[model samples]
Target: MNRRHLRWTVPAVTVFVASVVAIVLFTQVGGSAACAAGGSASYYSAGRNGMCNLGTPAEGLYAAVGRAEYAGGKACGTYLDVTGPNGTVRVQVVDLCPSCPAGKIDLGKGAFARIGALSAGIIPVTYGTTRDPQVGPLQVKLTGGTAYSALTAVLNNHGNPLSTVELQTPSGFAPMRQGEDNTWTAPSGAVTSPVTLRIADMYGHQATVAGLTLGPKDFQPTGTVLYGGPSPSPSDSPSPSTVESSAPSPAPVASAGPSSLPPAPKC
Candidate 1:
């Protein structure tokens, strides 16, 4: 009887799991025939500068898409019309979200607030591109390079996404490399003064901004029309095919003449 054994019992703990549900919304903008997709939208504060490097975060009209839609810089500078429970807002694809799943758009804080409440955190949205949006005049900005050589620029307010950019040099038309953040870099070569730029969109619509004198600063009020549609009237807008001649030349400015770079070695 002297040997008494003592035993202790522990109570079992309960575990709980939280379920997350995401709703998908879909809608077409401007009565366009383009296909619309349902997706989830969230907001982020990633700073004013984005992958496109065109608009700022303060503008509240920029968005970032998933890697699939980003296509590197291919999706940059493109516009998406997103509609939420509150209203519809058009936003530009300026950045990229590597972790965002397909069919999801991460919008800037300002842009998200326009469509839904900040407290919502995440919301359902329907998004698609609008055909020939009235984006007003084309504004071109020189982001890198000097008037002397190796210029990089970003074309804005063009409504449609640019597919290619060619610079008219003394030698010939040289294609520019579309870089991340909506910047187009000039090929390794001498780009003569009085730069002429020919920009084309995915729809084959082209716009030529002639007579640009590259300087170490920005250029605005370019007075270039965003060319789109078939057979624009001669007085109204120049046709994409014949804009080279019809478009007016930019004002003359001093340049670093005859600057050249070593040719890029063949891979």
Candidate 2:
């Protein structure tokens, strides 16, 4: 995956507005609309709200999405569009102040990242929801024995039902069998016991299920699985990530004061 790194630092300027009750903080990840597609994940905040550690949430976890970039590389107002509990939100880099480091976005108190489990600073995030952003009615289940649990999902995209569906486990690939109720199931038995899994739309869209402890006892539904199923593995068991989550890794977010600068500059 080609990852682009960019950061915007907005200077705190107190501008008095007649009708405005409060002065709001604004930060923009400097870039053209065309360039907003894919940049390295980072954090942005408005005021001196709360302090967050770096890379607490793993790379493939979920983060709440808030505030949209309307146009002209600026926001009309600070609007937060938080999805479900562990849903994916695509936020644009409007202005950049409260400048945390990479893999972090400081949205102040009203807006936050790690909404669910708060063990780490950062979490993994997908681009969109498991199903369509407007319409999502997908369900995944894990059954069968503990050694090779079967993961299944029913995908309904818009009105068109996809004929062939595929499910992914951490170890390898399995074809999903479409059921009468517009659902699909992956083949049973695999190398690993429980595996991390994901499903794909006809358009090659992928979604993830986080922290699916697929052992004998832990084989049950936990959080919402958007487009993908669950795949549990012993070695690669998903854990919370800080920028330092990967070990021997430099801190993605810098400490405050003199070193509080982004590794990458504004695009």
Candidate 3:
């Protein structure tokens, strides 16, 4: 064996891989995202209120993420399957714990008990989001909207962290900005009914929920799932809604990256 020849091989391969990652992070538009993180976990059972500002809880299992994972409400409504000493339990990002540091979650009492002992108060945990989780139809809570003010929607029932939320316009689909509470705020436009929304989750799944109506302060439900698993039974929905999946346009780029490349600018 030629030790001298093999000496540079491993380092060369490593450099190539790192360069490729740096290039992709700086250049690519959209790609699959993997959200694995090791962190400490604690339980919170007070307020039931969340930074999400969604009036009703999306589902039973939920948690409050720290500032790092919260990413300015990006983690809101996204389900996380956390594995602890007890087992793995899925939870929604219902709130934010500003005091909680990176890689930490203040899980709900019920959800925390499912994964860890209540007496422990806190425990080490690992958590991440899956690609195509079984999720219910889309629900939108429209509020802070009027003829004078543009409509704000706090979308619910997302299986993954949503990357893009847009509305159909005459010119094209106009993008909306996710507010601090995870509500996507509309641009300066008419908030008309029979509305059409184009959304993309982090896992590269895109779907259109058209023939949908958005009224001010309305918690409307649609018979649609973002992708994967199974469709909710007819009994689950009363609306005549349709969910159509289109070939995703370039998919949502995974914002996760190695702790290199100058660090992602905070949102």
**lDDT, model 3:** 0.58
Prediction 2 TM-score vs. true: 0.25
Counting only residues 3 or more apart in sequence or on different chains, how many pairs clash (N, Cα, C under 3 Å) in candidate 2? 40
lDDT of 3 by residue, 1-267 (tens): 110111111334334333321111111112333333455667764243467764323223567776766778887766566777788776656677777655567776766677777776666676654334455677776654457888677777665678899978788898989977778887875667777789987556678888766654555778876765443322311122222121011112133322332332221
Best by lDDT: 3
Which lDDT tens digits does candidate 1 get at residues 1-267?
111111222232111101223333322221222322346777775453566665442335667777656665767655676777777776666677877775678876766887877776676676754334444456676644554567787776665556788888777778988865667888765555577898876554678888676553543546776553322221312112211111111111112112251221121
Residue-level lDDT tens digits of model 2 in 1-267: 112222343233123112223212222322221222211133333211111111112232322223242222122111222232354332212233323332223322212343322322232322211212222233233444234465544222111113245545555555667543233457765434444555443323445544433334222333442332223312322232332221111111112112332222222
Could you tell me the TM-score of candidate 3? 0.68
CA shift of 85, model 3, Å: 2.1
RMSD of 1: 17.1
lDDT computed for candidate 1: 0.56
Worst ten-residue run, lDDT, model 3?
1-10
**Which sequence of candidate numbers ranks them by TM-score, best first?**
3, 1, 2
Better of 1 and 2 by lDDT: 1
lDDT for 67 in candidate 3 is 74
TM-score, per-candidate, Cα-based: 0.68, 0.25, 0.68
